[model samples]
Target: MQHDIAYDTAAGSQSITRAIGRVISPIAFLPADAAEFFTPVNTNKNWLSGEGKRLFDLAIALPLLIVLAPLLAAIALAVRLETKGPALFRQTRSGMCGRPFKIFKFRTMTVQEDGASVVQAREADPRVTRLGAFLRRYSLDELPQLLNVILGDMSLVGPRPHAMAHDDFYQSRISEYRHRFAAKPGMTGWAQVNGLRGPTPALEQMTSRVSHDVFYVRRASFSFDLKVLLSTPIEIIRPRNAV
Candidate 1:
């Protein structure tokens, strides 16, 4: 974990399509300073964090669950038949204010490691099943987390949750890491949509992801959440760092 904490502020440049998307989207993808892009701007004490965010979550997740019921059932069945384990995978993850909650996913791995110490999935890992690989690639494994959103243990948009072990490991080394807990964890966030998804074996990489998460925490709003939701499908089709 001994590495420079600095993240490249140069988000460089973006295309015309992305430029237009930046205006409507809350997360930045423009040629502007990425230092500004990742930095948290609003630290005002008066800003209400949970205001309208829950209503937004229910508004979107409820309909999505209804629409994808058949697909969810089919995926569950497929996962069960693919391996001997349960179709759904559950693990303890850090929620708002660092509280612990069991997060759900469609089991895409042959092994369910949920102990105090859990390893992250690497590319071409042998533990992945043929069906599991497809599920992870398209992010179908995350469909079950909509239940978490409904259950109010999570949000439709916020910092992506991490295992307790990961929280323990990085919180000490990274100064601003715990700031992510200011809001509930998310199904997708500013990090994932910007290709910051998946493993962070490198310290600087984790630092960048935390920066993005903190950015969301300071700027969480209906419009920002809407933009993150809109960008999710695009990220799924061309997944960046998902293993």
Candidate 2:
């Protein structure tokens, strides 16, 4: 799945588009910073504009959002009744190229923690409200992220975005960790499909998840995305590693 491309660290003045094109070229030269972000090891041949996946995300997300409008309303109501805060939880997450974007989810915890001191959720964590727990277990809390897909901030299948604080910590600890950000974030991802969902309580768990993510980035294609999409429903129903 690997593509061979030349590397030149002196192309710092080129635009990101040019930089990406260079990476795909047989004789490529990229700036040092760009090289760090986009490498041949993680770049796929079918990774052009990704318009097909983007269109697919909108195609499914738009209708699903409309069809599930009522259900979403009900969930919001439940969250509101169960907690003193807003039903929707918005937190900053690192997007492609390490850009910051606010991610949306259903409010699952009693506290809205968006700071550097945010803690990972544990099984039967006291911070999780009863209704919130149900939402999280089924991953219904991620429904709101459909909006993010429509807005071009995410995709239906890719690597999931970590919280800003978590990203900062992991990028420093794992050299390949930040490589996952080359692709746009997703609601469900290769890691999730492979049972890497839920809290990464251990560093090894997070590292394993990153491995799957980098694999997706290298092998990403229209067909591969379809497989991930089709397999997702079965995973959801069976409820493997989800919290």
lDDT of all predictions, in order shown?
0.78, 0.78
Against the true structure, candidate 1 reaches a TM-score of 0.80
Cα lDDT for residue 209, candidate 2: 92
Q: Weakest 10 consecutive residues, lDDT, candidate 1?
A: 24-33
Number of backbone collisions per candidate: 0, 0
How close is every model to the real structure, measured as TM-score? 0.80, 0.84
Residues 1-243, candidate 1: write the lDDT tens digits: 223322222232335334543331122122312223223333531221444777888888999999999999999998888789899999998776566789999998888888679888888989989999899888999999999999988988888998887887887777778667667789999999999988788989999999998887787677788899999999999988888
Over the stretch 81-157, how does candidate 2's per-residue lDDT look in tens digits? 87799999999887766567799999999898997877889887999988888888888999999999898878888
Error of 2 at 2 (Å): 38
Provide the global lDDT of candidate 1 against the true structure.
0.78
Q: Pull out the clashing pairs in model 1.
A: none
Give the clash total for candidate 2. Answer: 0
Error of 1 at 127 (Å): 1.2
Worst 10 residues of 2 by lDDT: 24-33
